[model samples]
Target: MAVTILGMDIGGTNLRSGFVNDRFELSEFRISSSQAICGEKAPENIAAYIERLMAETGIRPDAISIGFPSTLDKARKRLLSTPNLEGLDDMNMVERLENALHIPVYIDRDVNLLFLCDCHANHLTADVIIGCYVGTGFGNVIAIGGEILVGKNGVAAELGHIPVRGLTLDCPCGNVGCVEMIASGKALKTLQETWYPEEAIGTLFTLHASDEPVRGFINDLALPIATEINILDPDEIILGGGVLQMDGFPKGALEDAIRLHARKPYPEQALRFHYSGEKQENGVIGAAILAFRHMKREKGQPV
Candidate 1:
């Protein structure tokens, strides 16, 4: 029998779980809302939800991995902070889940998994890889030496929060004018409300190609992408997220901006893009890969 791996992706609004084999085929996957996990009991509720998912699937796995959209310490054992989800501050996530499940648990920021999936699937090996997800919000992950790069404080690779233009707006992380504030879902929403109160969020990009307001929003979104490109000229830069896949996004315009704003040389010429599907299973499969990697490391094998 093939060994199974269980994986989970914990988002602000939903929790997705699944089982996968060595080939990265997902099965018995499930998704459910996370609205009920509120307040002090939030951690326990998450644990309970995982248990229920495993029971429903009836496939016991030797290991489990979960991804969270939050800042982690270099060890990936605790959630240092989650701006969108307030309940997870200072939580010993790995220990709690491992104790409850009696199985090994692995965890990391969700965007890192996107990078891992892209690298593994593409069969590209590089000493440095940078993955950026551009959607309602920006997510960034960097990998080095075939392992997820964790900074000393575990809060490394937070490229989204880098400030730009000093534009003041409330950030979920309690800052103002963060890069996320200027170029995220919330930023787009604010721009729509202020400049084009009558337009829908989805239609901003559609109108942008012709309308001035729409164009402004697109420019804001591109600024940070350009900044990152100039700073880190990775062997590969993977771009995937809801925003990049949106109907009216000016891919040509964005790339133009990136090239114009980024420094000259091979870094500008070598830029590549990969857009994640709306139904992409990277969340679960990447989580499974994390567990598998951890198991290998525990056995004194290469990860």
Candidate 2:
């Protein structure tokens, strides 16, 4: 019988969970508010949610995988920090969930899971892939030989937090000058409210994409991406997230800005860029895939 995995994606605002088979088919999808399920006690709430899911679906998963929007330990066993979700820092999430469910539980940065799913769905065969997602905040992940590149500190590829000159707004990460403060969906909303107060946030790009302020915003968004391309010389760069999927998002303009900042000579000319549209269920589906891969690796089987 093919392995069935339970996957959960815990975001700052929403919670999504589902069951996926080894073949990557998803079912029993559910969505809820993150705060409603767990106002401050996220780990406990997640455990309870898993219990509820299993009861409702009547499926016993071989393993469980959760994607977290936070920094985790190098072992991917504990959350070190969750800037957006309170009371999640330093929690032993893996152990708690495993004990509750009597099955293996795997956890990793949410962006890493997204990258994995995109690679599988798109059939990307690159040796090295970089994923940059611009959503409520900026999310980034790097994969080498199909494995996420977790650095010694387990915080590698945090492209969004990279400091940029002249961007001094305070970020949720407690850092000033971070690119995310000026270039993410949150930033776009701020810009829209400030200059184009009459326009809806969703329509800013559509209505004023040609305006200088809007163009500058796009450049700010592309700078960190180009910087990563120059350093990694990745085989492929996949860009996605809510911001990229916004109405009338200037995809071509963003691409042009990236090429402008990317290193001259070879990488810029050879770089491959793939723009992925947002999928409501991708986070949960990717979590399931991670669970399957983790189980296979543990059993000395190919993933």
- Top lDDT: which candidate number? 2
lDDT score, residue 137, model 2? Answer: 94
Query: Which regions of candidate 1 are displaced past 4 Å?
Result: none
Q: Any runs in candidate 2 off by more than 4 Å, and if so which?
A: none
- Number of backbone-clashing residue pairs for each candidate, in the order shown: 3, 0
Across 48-157, the per-residue lDDT of candidate 2 in tens digits comes to: 88888888879989889888889998899999988887778888889977887788899998887788888878889688899999989999998888778899989898
lDDT of each: 0.76, 0.87
Candidate 1 lDDT score relative to the true structure: 0.76
Task: Point out the worst 10-residue segment of candidate 1 by lDDT.
Answer: 272-281
Candidate 1 lDDT, 1-303, residue by residue in tens? 576888887776677778889888988777876566645776688778767777887777877888888888788899888777658888888898888878788888888776677777777677767777876678888777776667778887778888767577777878777888877777777787998788777887776576776666667777777777777677776777777777777878777767777777867888876555456577888888787787778889988
What's the C-alpha lDDT at position 243 in model 2?
87
Deviation of model 2 at 107, angstroms:
0.8
